[model samples]
Target: MDRVWEAELRLPTPLVELRDPLFGTCRVLLKRDDLIHPDVPGNKWRKLKYLVRDARDRGADTLLTFGGARSNHVRAVAALGERLGFRTVGVIRGEERPTNPGLRRAQERGMTLHYLDRATYRRKSDPDVLAALHDRFGGAYVVPEGGTTPLAFPGLAELVNEFDRPYDAVVCAVGTGGTLAGIAAALPAGRRAIGISVLRGAWSLDAEVAALHRSVLGHPLDNWTIDHRFHCGGFARRDARLDTFLARFGDRHGWAPDPVYVGKALLGLSVLTGAGEFDGETVVAIVSGPGAG
Candidate 1:
């Protein structure tokens, strides 16, 4: 397989200072992973790096992954497949909408999109469902939803290794918990990583992240934590308070984070900082990317 696509990615993405009253007394820096690639950005790129290599090593010409209609993971997979000369299949949850921008972009990148009803999507990992998909797609390499498998950890770990300055903590929004798991696994003693969950009522995210840690390193590390209070209703749902914050953020910073992930993360950081959690510490916030759709 050609390795040309690797050269196009911006590794060790720039870290820039973020000044705002929301962060209270803490000095914050933004890790601009969003600039890594136009199509495959941030943790999406990180998660896919090794999975693509694994697919190639197995002599697979097709990569099939699961996600919702607007998933960044699906879009990234499609873009990666186009760049690397592999066939891509996106097994999407819910009804198909041909007009959806993300899915349309994926299709333009030569991905075959297949939709599964919500109930069937819930069983996406079941043996029977997977077997049927394999039969339909003809031996494609499978990547799970959000690309959270063990193969993804190494790539995410590299993100932490690329930090150029000292920091007391690193923070990011959690969708699948893979990014948190990877960062937590790589952090040296004393420093910590915090995740702001984007899914409401996702109380089990901590366990899920720990399980991911165990999958990658044989044990769960303790230098990380997740804050579930800042999801702003739930995944893909935002209320007036969040909207107002984002508007103010945009006016001050010249860019507004997407409501689904990064915005929620910054909000959590704001609340946490105000509550004296990071009173005098320097923090780095991972700017993952704008939402997929």
Candidate 2:
């Protein structure tokens, strides 16, 4: 079995137009990675690519990964694995609830879901926990939560090639910081890369971002930075205004915005663009996943 399943997709051309006149100052283009794969979509699909390959190369029949109560990564990976005939397992953080929709969906998709207490889940980054999972799962390949690794970044870097016009800035939401890191590494010099934080108490993501640059790009990013002001009380936080914005934007552009990634990215982009952050230049915001459709 091939580790990485190449998702069939039509990579979008340059300059995604904004239907909102409010964002007219700067031209916004979207690398429609959302269209990358039907099942495993967008940056998640790319990040999972080499990891899946590595898993297969290691002779693993099962794929194990970690995620939150409502992780897009979980949704994508479970569906991808089931479609590809690999037994899938999701080590989900937080208590298993009778009403968790994402978990239910994952289970319905045939993924073995393991619910872990927050204390144990918090230690997911530690090698000991990973080793334990490996031991229990009998050598199942473990992909770090969100598949954020050096291998993942290189695939995301290829997104830079799809844009024709030189961009003044590129913005994306940071979860594990993989997507932004890859884009920053691949973007041309003088272009600014801004990461909008999505995880609360995620102060250490900058180090992850920097490390990705060094490892994937073979250099360091001194100019790129992150904005943590509007994580909106952490991941999965909701506001009526965000819903309205997402609905309106999607209606105009015929795109869907999932609450986790693209929703926050659009939220930050709205604020930053309104603040004249892109007043004198063109900006490209990576639309990481497909809209509600």
Candidate 3:
């Protein structure tokens, strides 16, 4: 608890223009959440802010969290723990190898890595599993995968308030549904939100978002929709089309996006805008992470 994290470190990021000729008067802007902070950036950090504060308020010494091998959420938690002064334990989805980038970075950040098979990982929030972890790691705070807890909604809602002007729509890639819900909940009247799902055949993300939105904001939200056409196979799965788009986008903009999330999202945004779904209206797409490679 010796390190000082300035309250003002939660800097507001700028929005960038993503040019495409066909859109004509319609503008495509990118909210640069990926640049929020070097170590704890994007929705990953936005989603963790309140959770970390709550954990410290409850006198938690360690934050135990769950995620897949390449989860940005796990990386954010570990990095936050180190930078903000807290112990961390990462319950990884598989028996991840030491070379995995996310796992390696988490370990470097002083987060203890715990492995469980796929089946066990699915039951991560199970009372028995949580109890076992508590028994082993003491009274640590637990952050669900993707930091989807109710407390996180407030931090994410802050992102929506960043716009000085109204946008017709805001878009982001959805993993655990928390980010989408937060954006939708905080949007002013007349604006909308969209989520390009990066996962397929898992639990219903829409249901999860709906439930979380209701839990946090006390009502159902009707201002957003989910587009699943960009999964590109599944979470962390890629295809040639997505790869080609990523390469071309990077070449054009000098920004390489991770295939898992940001790439698909930009592609979806391009498609939707080009198709006139958002023509003549100001649109904003979220760049949620710095591409890993």
Candidate 4:
């Protein structure tokens, strides 16, 4: 598996300058983690690398995880399973959609799809719900929604270490808060990380990132903060402002970022820059890639 990872995955993903008028005085660079792989791109690769290893170490032959129908995490897990020869099961939230591209890709990659109602999915962490899954799957190793776990931090830390230049701050779109927590935990002494939340009204994201830090690093660090004002609407929801920004961004940059995560983060950064928040600072925005489909 290690050999496969080393041979197949792109390490030290390219860092390139992002010249945008919206950034004003900020020197913005894009950490192109999105280019890490055709499948399992960006933070998905970072978060899952170790969890899969841990599953193997624990003698588990199957990987079980939770995600929405269009979840990038689900597609990444299925891709990893295909690459590494592990049985994969994706417990999807809401009704199954046979035509959903992401779910269909996972199915093609040999992932068993299981659908759960929204209410039951909310209780996925409950022991009873987990036990029921275990009974059906027979002792599969379970990865949480968005693949955020203590085991995931180590791989995420490597992302920070791969930076080839100095910067005042690093930024990424916050979904489960794992990517931000992991990056912030590994940042150098003076640098900081800012997370742009993609979930509307996600006031608890700061607390969640802090708890993740405490879980893995033994204490929470103060080098990180989250911005909840730019969700556009909610997860997978996009409004006219975001759509306009994405269109302009794609026209200028020659790449179209998915509205769900990367687009939202860049839009937030642009707003922050316009407000003089990142004036005269160097910011590296992580292009975590478009989620499945």
Task: Flag the better candidate by lDDT, 1 or 3.
Answer: 1
Q: Write down the lDDT that model 3 would get.
A: 0.82
Tally clashes: model 2. Answer: 4
TM-score computed on alpha carbons, candidate 1: 0.97
| TM-score, structure 3 vs. true | 0.93
Show pairs that collide, candidate 4.
Answer: none
lDDT of each: 0.90, 0.77, 0.82, 0.91
The sequence of per-residue lDDT tens digits that candidate 1 reaches over residues 102-181 is 88999999999999989999999999999999999999999999998898888888998888898999999999898888
Point out the worst 10-residue segment of candidate 1 by lDDT. Answer: 94-103
Question: In model 1, where do residues sit more than 4 Å from their true spots?
Answer: 1-3, 96-98
lDDT by residue (tens digit), candidate 2, 1-293? 33354424555533465557757587877766777776677887778877777777777889888887767788888987887777999998887543376677778989988877889899987889887887877777778888888878657766777787777888888888888888888778788889888778798989889877887667788767888866777777867777887788878878657777778887888888899888867878887875322
Q: For model 3, how does the per-residue alpha-carbon lDDT over 1-293 read when each residue is reduced to its tens digit?
A: 22366453546888877786645567888888888877778887788888898998888879999877767778889988988789999988776543476678889999999988888888888899889999999988988888888877788788888876668899898888888898888888989999999888645888888998778778899999999888889878898878888888778778777788888888787778778788689988888876532
Model 4 stretches astray by more than 4 angstroms:
96-99
**Looking at candidate 3, what is the lDDT of residue 23?**
52
Report clash pairs, candidate 1: none
Pick the winner on TM-score between candidates 1 and 2: 1
- Where model 3 places Cα greater than 4 Å from the true spot, the runs are 1-3, 7-10, 22-25, 96-98, 291-293
Candidate 1 lDDT (Cα, 0 to 1): 0.90
